[model samples]
Target: MPSIWSPESDTHITAQYSQKTLDQKVRNKSALQKECGWPVEAKRAMVCLPLGMTEALGGQVFRSMLPGLFTQSMELLILGKGSKEYGTLFTELQKEHGHRIAILPASEASVHKILAASDIALFLANVESSPEVRACLSYGVIPVAPECDTLENYDPVQERGTGFLYAPAKNPEQTAWSAFAALARALETFKFPFDWKTIQRQCMESTK
Candidate 1:
């Protein structure tokens, strides 16, 4: 089963976080390095997103804005879970882009590890019910959610300024880029990850 981030369990986590507070998370600067093997001061603009959302988010205005926002070195990790059935479009995305694209088959444990190491989570599926977003928040990770219908009802932040929501959800690529940029900004802004105490509080509040 997909990981469920119900407020029922222990609420210190969700599925995504904002990368705006990168500079402030000095203590965690070590954790990301230690846990996911990312270099300290690793400021590459990257995003880990599900593939279906990418295709769904494909619109003109958003795609045009991405190149300017992300560095050529910045990477985008596309997680399909091998079930997204978005191969044709994704192939084009990689073909059009260069080394900036890294596609992976989704495995819960491995994805969790990647999220632990990643700076931002770009969720396009309108499915942010996973508690891992909260899990990411505890680690100072942030998510950029497309303002799609499914996500409209859920609070990506679960109440604490952990993640961000990109409105209109039109341009998948540009929204992803904007999310990547937002993550960088968020990391620099909220450096401190929420602890279990806070997570539990989130869980309690969200469940209600």
Candidate 2:
């Protein structure tokens, strides 16, 4: 069991096991990616981890973001071995969005390599600070997680220009729509005359 840490203010939810080990893991994985010469210089918004440890967290939330993200030429890399529950859905999504989406399980080296190739790491789950978020920061990949009370202290995403924050939805059907809108907001922030590289450097520098 992995343990996920949240802000002390949100004591209502108990710590989960899987995401607790994410921070250090991100650091290590990012280092490995650098050592292996994987590049993390792209400006694409890539939503990942559904096929692996992050599966089932977002439910149907991610499905709605495909159209928007793909239109922007952003690549969504869903790594890890997907659970049986989502196998069919994943397959269908892959077929429909394979032009910009990758649905498959990969090795650690491969995972790091993929991370190195990403820019924004999207989170559709209720996670305030997931290991994937920490990992993204380590690789200079900005994190875009849901906005909620539990993450009141997580400033990176909440603060303007550092990252994007979308409100989380309670209804399962609304989850996808909320996530898509949030991601759209995030895309707007990353687009245009905005200096993405400079923002990336700033974000990396601000990380502890």
How displaced is residue 38 in candidate 1, in Å? 11
Please provide, for model 1 over 1-208, each residue's C-alpha lDDT reduced to its tens digit, 9 standing for 90 to 100. Answer: 3343321232222323323333333433234344434444445544565433344444233355455535434456666543344555455776776445655556655454455445566554454555555444444345555443322222335534435556534545555565555444543433434431242233224323
The backbone clash count of each candidate, in order, is 35, 5
TM-score for each model: 0.49, 0.63
Residue-wise C-alpha lDDT for candidate 2, range 1-208, written one tens digit per residue: 1122222222221221112222222333344334434444334455555224334677566655555556664556666465666666666777776555665456654555555545567777765545656555545555666774323222334443545567666774576666666566656655642355545555454444
Candidate 2's C-alpha lDDT?
A: 0.51
Worst 10-residue stretch by lDDT in candidate 1?
A: 6-15
lDDT of every predicted structure (CA atoms): 0.45, 0.51
